[model samples]
Target: MSNPKPRIALIGECMIELQQRADGSLLQSFGGDTLNTAVYLSRALGDSGAVDYVTALGDDSFSDAMCERWAEENIGLQRVQRLPGRLPGLYCIQTDAAGERRFLYWRNEAAVRECFTTPAAGPILAALPDYDVLYFSGVTLAVLGEQGRGKLLETLVEARRRGAQVVFDNNFRPRLWASIEAARVAYRSVLPYVELALLTVEDEQALFGHADSEAVFAAYAQLGTPEVVLKRGAEACLIRCDGQSYEVPAVRVEHVVDTTAAGDSFSAAYLASRLLGGSPVEAAEAGHRLASRVIQVPGALIPKD
Candidate 1:
């Protein structure tokens, strides 16, 4: 008989998002890097695999709406923990004339900061090894403080030993980290256990100070990861897998609206395609195709239609 479909758990936080217009009005929504990946990955995988979101949130109306929305997307919510008297983080995005965006955050006391430190985290961490795949991004590491990161690293090591594939996306946002050295240490700690890495070239450069794609690729190669995919916006994504390298071109978009989740969406499709048995080249193509469409929309998520 064929093997059972794999189960994937993406760990991170989902926050309340506000987009500030030139007129000084704010449009409200929900967005987080790993959450964006979870939603897109679930949509890309459909019923082929089980996709679950693992996070902590407050028992508020906004949190309720977020959970309701995830349910409608067919994402599993069994690992979500509700904390009383706490609420999700909030941030406002302001875009320039060139569509470049800046974010102002109000998330220091967010409930998710305590996610991996809560009593409920013990069972969740213990059960993580049972999944076929575990995915997270740099933002996940940033939110989970040093102690929490140590715990998460231990869980990742155990999960890998149990044959779970650990997929990581390097979605680096410098302001989220206390210091560049701290971020470097955290990333380096997790690199050895990662099976597949989906990296954005720009973010890699910003985080690690790599001069170019070759430098980025060289750095990951030193980590001994077998599969690495590097995404370069509006250009080809470079892939190195199974002793072969491939360049997959991105689909050109005429008009770009919001590039908020372009990398997140790409990571989702790439991982989804691989989980479905697609080769690295095919997976890269799928990622680019999805991201091309995502950049045309105004928010992190686009309408299913």
Candidate 2:
């Protein structure tokens, strides 16, 4: 992006997080892959850029607290839609000794499933093309469903035509899709409009059956994506940009408390550094530093300090 501090809107769901402690107690919090990135992106940009979250919620106290927290984090609330009878989704996080996490979801009927289908979405959709950047994830595609996704795809088409950069992260979850074929269709449909793709090697392998980073890069290249970052956990991230490839090493960490938001934090710092006019290598380094710190913490969101 040309602007040092660009206007960015992240589209996805934020759920009530129930993190299971070692003592067998549940710790309440708010977290989602895209929401984690939004909070970190807002912090990384400070007052220089704009970060907005686009989603739907209900009239429940949980939803109220979510908006309150997002406001506190400096994420814009203008695009939030409120549905009277529905409620936000919930999820539980379980981490093993290695800090690798597993998720249990209760969100088949989340309010965010209707985020782009509401009456309020018309204005939000209209305003989207004006932003400097539009960001979303594979999970965002999964939850938004058919109708909501249609609106989002249409907005992305317009946004691209108006010169807005569209960013996508491949944070895939198999359980969220009806089949692997369905996920492939969804991903392929939106990829043509994407300018930068923040992809995890595992996700790309699982989603498209790519055997290695070369295959992943070749596939995205064939799809005509300008830039792609292939993140391999604990290994160096490979960046393919401007027809050049660079390998930026990940930070070494002896301990990982929870791997919940490692990739989210990485993407946040990467985007922030890019907006601040850093090169691909510099941005990837920033991502590694932030992700190294995030993995040392226990949750999706670490302390701002």
Candidate 2, residues 187-243: lDDT per residue as tens digits? Answer: 889999998999988898899899999999999899889889988778999999979
Distance from true position, residue 110, model 2, in Å?
0.7
TM-score of each: 0.96, 0.99
Tell me how far the alpha carbon of residue 287 in candidate 1 is from the true structure, in angstroms, after superposition: 0.8
lDDT of 1 at 202: 83
What is the overall TM-score of model 1 with all chains considered together? 0.96
Rate residue 134 of model 1 by lDDT.
92
lDDT of 2: 0.94
Off by over 4 Å in 2: none
Alpha-carbon lDDT of model 1: 0.89
**Clash pairs detected, candidate 2:** none
lDDT string for model 1 (1-305, tens) is 01257799999989999988789998898999999999998998898888899999999999999999999999999999999999999988887765567889998888888888999999999999899999988999999889889889999999999989899998888999989999999999999999899888888888889999889889888888889888888889899886699999899888887788888999999888888888888888999999999888777888897
lDDT of each: 0.89, 0.94
